[model samples]
Target: MRQGLGTQLRHLIDLLDGAVSAAYDEAGIDYRPRYTPVMRALEGGQPHTVSQIAEAAGITQPAATQTVALMIKEGLLESSPGVRDARQKVVRLSARGRDLLPQLHLCWQATRAAADSLDGDLPYPLSEALAAAIAALQHQPFGARIRKARAAITKETS
Candidate 1:
């Protein structure tokens, strides 16, 4: 049996994340690869709401909220209730997070260079292909395409 798109993508994620996580571990940094997006969003050194982080990080709001909670617990981030909307939480990088920036930036640069090398080895750059996929999905969501395919398959079986 052949692997599906989701399976292949998951494997790719596992490979990339495993390497990145290992690099961080080897560097003596207590950081998770999953925190990169949020870290990048917070590097401006300003407090932002979860929605803002989600938008900046290109992740879902729920994912942002969850990551925020984990980061806060890890001491990489601190949060307080929004001034205008007490229900909303404003998030900022903690002093601990700031301390890690110099090291993290170096690690990130090396990781990015490695990715560039991998891209060069391919006939098509993975980053370009990924960007194209994102654009296509934005134009017509995967759900809409799945529904159309499902309808056709059902009609044929019926």
Candidate 2:
């Protein structure tokens, strides 16, 4: 039972990833898997510091910095000059990033539809049971974090 649950969870994640990737490709967007964190952070609030982005993304500062720098170079994000401390910069999405929101929304809708379709294939009781299990699992601490991150993605699309 435990193994089956684990497999189901893993497969769910795989399905979501594949759906999102396919949607992104269909939208003619250059998708960077790492961008999800930054986008989520931006959705949570504006002008996130490098540390903030790192924390939300669950990545090291160096990785966040590298990712942020790349985004900046791509004109997806811009850094505001530090007011209190000259060394600290606040980062926000640029015009390009704003323009991409609609495409991202489409991607999310497609993914959700795919999930719904997949769910519909299962027999009634199994589908209901599987959903309940998944929901219960999501209420756990680790699962909570995943849910929060997923919420952030939804926020970004809005």
Candidate 3:
């Protein structure tokens, strides 16, 4: 039997993540893939509001908030109230986080190079396919498409 789209997609993620995680282990870096986007947003040593980091990371505010909280607990990030808006939490890398950057950057570079090699081997680059998928989803969300399909099935069954 053929695999469903979601199953195939998850398998691809598992393969990629398994290798990347192994790379981090081999490099002696205590980092997770989920932290990469948040770290990228703060890598310049600038403090930013959670909303700003979320936008920069292309993730939801809740995701950024949760990641920041976890990073803070790990001693990898510092969080403070926003200067202009006291209710807003601004965050930046902690001293420990800054210290970890050199190793993390090296690992990132190696992983990126490996990804490029993998892309070159594929018939159609996965990056291009991901970009196209994101664009299409932005144009018409998957939920909307699912609802449309459900309506058609309901009508046919009735």
Candidate 4:
């Protein structure tokens, strides 16, 4: 049952990712969906340091730094000297990035609508259910124990 659930979850996630990729390609945006969460965090009218972005995006510092570097290179993000720590650069969306917000919204909306249509008459309750599931899973007790057990089983089977 666990394996079946995992497989279904993987399929759904992959399909969603593919949809996002197709939407971005159709919109002529050379960006990745992995960057969306971080970008949306910055779009909340807050300049964030690399560490802050890492925390907010639930990614490692180095991962955030690499993504930020790519965004900077693409002219989607810029950094300025930090207020207290001159060494830490604060990052925010560039003018061009801010301008792309509307287009991004439209593209995402269109993609979401298409996906929903494919699934037949859709409602909003799935989002709430998904959020609850994520919260429950993230806070689940014995998570490490379950993971260790799975690893042990995999090792033994292999």
Candidate 5:
């Protein structure tokens, strides 16, 4: 049986993520790829709310919230009541997170170089393909495509 598009895409992501994680392990860096976006957002030295972090990280608010909670538990981030709005909370990198930045930066540089090499070896660069796919999805989302297919199926059945 042939692999589905979603399965193939997920496998590729897992492979890439595993490679990066292995590199981090070899370098003795305790970090996860998923943490990168949130860390990068806080790297600017600005305290931001969950919504702000989600926007900056290009992730959903719930995801940001969950990541923040985990980071807080891991001592990588700290949160405080929002200055203006007491009900809201703002988050920033903790001392431990700041200490890890230098190593992370070096790892990031190496990872970028490795990715560039991979892109060069491939028939088409994965980054460009991903960007194009995302752009296409923005114009016509998968949900809409599924709905159209479903409507066609219903019409045929009727």
Candidate 6:
């Protein structure tokens, strides 16, 4: 038995994320790679709801909510009731998060350069391949394929 694509992808992500995490540690920045998306989404200095953050960050609503809660606990983010919706909490960067942006931006640039180098070393760029896969999935989702395969299997068994 060989590892499946999902497992392989997770391994690759762990490797890349570990490298970035080490770099952040070296710089003495208390940040996680998971925080980047939310930080970038709030960079424009506007408070946004968790749903809005999820959309802007290209992540799930639950993931955004969890990240926001963690950031809040870390003193990097603050939240308040949404103006339009009392039940919705709007999130914004705290002073600590704002102060860390300059360092974070430098780290981001360096990380991009490193990723480019890695991509250059590979036979095919991982980022490009991932983008292509995502595009293909958007055109024909995996769920639909799974359903079709199940139907074929049922017909064969019948």
TM-scores for every predicted model: 0.96, 0.57, 0.94, 0.69, 0.93, 0.93
Off by over 4 Å in 1: none
**Which lDDT value does model 3 have at 98?**
94
Clashing pairs in 1: none
Error of 4 at 29 (Å): 2.1
lDDT of 2 by residue, 7-27 (tens): 977897787687677768777
* Pairs clashing within candidate 6: none
Model 1 lDDT tens row, 1-158? 99999999999999999999999999999999989999999998999999999999999999999999999999999999999999989999999999999999999999999999999999999999999999999999999999999999999999
Q: List CA RMSD, all candidates.
A: 1.0, 12.0, 1.2, 4.8, 1.4, 1.4
Residue 21's lDDT in candidate 6 = 95
Model 5: how far residue 31 lies from native, Å: 1.4
After superposing candidate 6 on the true structure, give the runs of residues whose Cα lies further than 4 Å from its correct spot. 153-158
Candidate 5, residue 120: the lDDT equals: 96
lDDT of the candidates, in the order given: 0.97, 0.79, 0.93, 0.83, 0.93, 0.95
TM-score comparison, 2 vs 4, better candidate: 4
Give Cα distance to truth, residue 87, candidate 5, Å: 1.3
Report the Cα lDDT for residue 49, model 4: 97
Best by lDDT: 1
Off by over 4 Å in 4: 1-7, 55-63, 112-126, 145-158
Considering lDDT, which of the candidate structures 1 and 4 is the better prediction for this target? 1
Residue 78 in candidate 1, Cα distance off native in Å: 0.5
Q: For residues 1-158, what per-residue lDDT tens digits would candidate 5 score against the true structure?
A: 99999999999999999999998999998788889899999998899999999999999999999999999999999999999998999999999999999999998899899999999999999889989999999999999999999999999999
In model 6, the number of clashes is 0
Pairs of residues at least 3 apart in sequence or in different chains that clash in candidate 2: none
Instruction: For residues 1-158, write the lDDT of model 4, one tens digit per residue.
Output: 35676798889889888878887998888778777767877987689999999999888899999999999999989999999989999999999788888888887678678766755655555556667877787787457759989999999999
Writing each residue's lDDT as its tens digit, candidate 6 over 50-70 gives 999999999999999999999
Q: TM-score for model 2?
A: 0.57
Please identify which of the two predictions, 1 or 5, would achieve the higher lDDT against the true structure: 1
Order of quality (TM-score)? 1, 3, 5, 6, 4, 2
Which one wins by lDDT: 4 or 5? Answer: 5
Better of 1 and 3 by TM-score: 1
